[model samples]
Target: MTKSLIDILDLSTGEIDELIETANRIIENPQAYAHKCEGKKLATLFFEPSTRTRLSFEAAMYELGGHVLGFSEAASSSASKGESVSDTVRVVSGYADIIAMRHPKEGAPMVASMKSLVPVINAGDGGHNHPTQTLTDLLTIRRKMGRLDHLTVGLCGDLKFGRTVHSLIGALSRYEGIRFVLISPQELTIPDYIREEVLEDGHQDYVETTDLEAVMPELDILYMTRVQRERFFNEADYIRLKDSYILTREKLDSAKKDMCILHPLPRVNEISVDVDEDSRAGYFDQALYGKYIRMALILKLLGVE
Candidate 1:
């Protein structure tokens, strides 16, 4: 059977640690592993529009001395002509050493994995999960805060549809003393399944609040997510909270000086531009880490490292 990274659960804690270590090494000395995947080819089958994720995968493949081929958006692909994901995977597997796919439908990659001859990677699948992003988050947190354990991480903004938050909570649940402050509107609160399956079952300490300022001082890491206008059911609701949860300069006044701030980019103003100047704002640096980790991922998946 071929291996696939469909979920964070697919990797043991030790494997996760090794991957992070490899990623750190790749970041520190890119040239040492430049030809790691010398003759490999990577096919990125993105069924959604994600500039950052797509480019990260492409850059990763290139840095590993591998070639990359794939479409950036669904409309540009065979999917627009009604090609099934399974058929797409079967076809791409013939041409590439591995396939990384992103789809708007939940569990799409899982279905593709069953048919794929090469390894499959879930770039994302609706709000279901994004394991690679979770891996990137884990590596970023460990690199920045020095450890993932015993940190109070505040996940602020759209909790219901933020796949990154769901994946992060799952990844951190395996660690100890990692408290969460899930800040979101009641309508956009963390789903019942997440609360029941992860927070409650793990017995992790967490608080749900609409107030961002009240939780700012208590956080070791503040993970901001976009309060997407498209996620709201009504225009008035979007207008109200779009400005409500913004992390502004005034709001950061009382926050700990050393607290780290992170965001999955293409942000629609959830974090203020002024806050970017702060040393603790690590999202841009975090984005670069995504590419590095992805480079490590491609090498590992191709059995080269």
Candidate 2:
């Protein structure tokens, strides 16, 4: 059976630490690992639209001396001709050394992985999981704070439908002394599986609040998420909740001196552009880390020495 990253839990805590260490080393000496994936090929089969994740995977492969091939949208692939994910991945897997797939439905990537001839990565599958993004978030947290544990992390905005938020919480729950301030409206609170199964089951400390400012002071890391319009079934409900949390320069006044603000990018109006000038803004840096961490992940998945 071929290995795949269908969920963040697929990797142990030690593996995450190893990936973070590899990413840091790559940051320090990128030239040395340039040829790690030479002669390898990566297939990016994005059935949904994406700018950052897709490009980062492509860029990671390129930087690792590997080639990238695949469609950026479903219509561009054989899926437009009514081909199943299993067939598409099985065929593509024969052509590429690894596969990264994103689909609108949950567990689609898992199905793809079972049929894939090589390693398969879930670029994203609905609002289910995006393990690589979780890996990126972990790397960003480790880089900025120098520690992943013993800190209060604030996760603000659409926790109910944000896959990145779900994945982040799952990954962070493994660490010691990690308190979560889940900031969202009552209507947009986190899923029961995460709250009951992951947090409550693990006996992790957490608090849910509708106010972002009230918890801003206590946070060492603030992970903000946009209220995604696509996830909503009703337009009226989305319009009402979309502006629930907006992080601005003034909001940072109450925050800790060294608090790091992170966002899984392509942010809508959730984060004001002016906050980009703030010293604590780590979202852009977070995106850059995504590429390096993905580079490390590609190396690991491909069994590259």
Best of the candidates, lDDT: 2
Q: Give the TM-score of candidate 1.
A: 0.96
25-106: candidate 1 lDDT, tens digit per residue: 9988999989888889999999998889999999899998989999989999999999999999999999999999999999
Q: Write the per-residue lDDT of candidate 2 for residues 196-267, one digit (tens) a residue.
A: 999999999999999898889999999998876787778998887766688989999999999999999888
Which portions of model 2 show Cα errors greater than 4 Å? 228-244
Lowest summed lDDT over 10 consecutive residues: which window, candidate 1?
296-305
Candidate-wise lDDT, in order: 0.90, 0.92
- Regions of model 1 farther than 4 Å from truth: none
Instruction: Give the best candidate by TM-score.
Output: 1
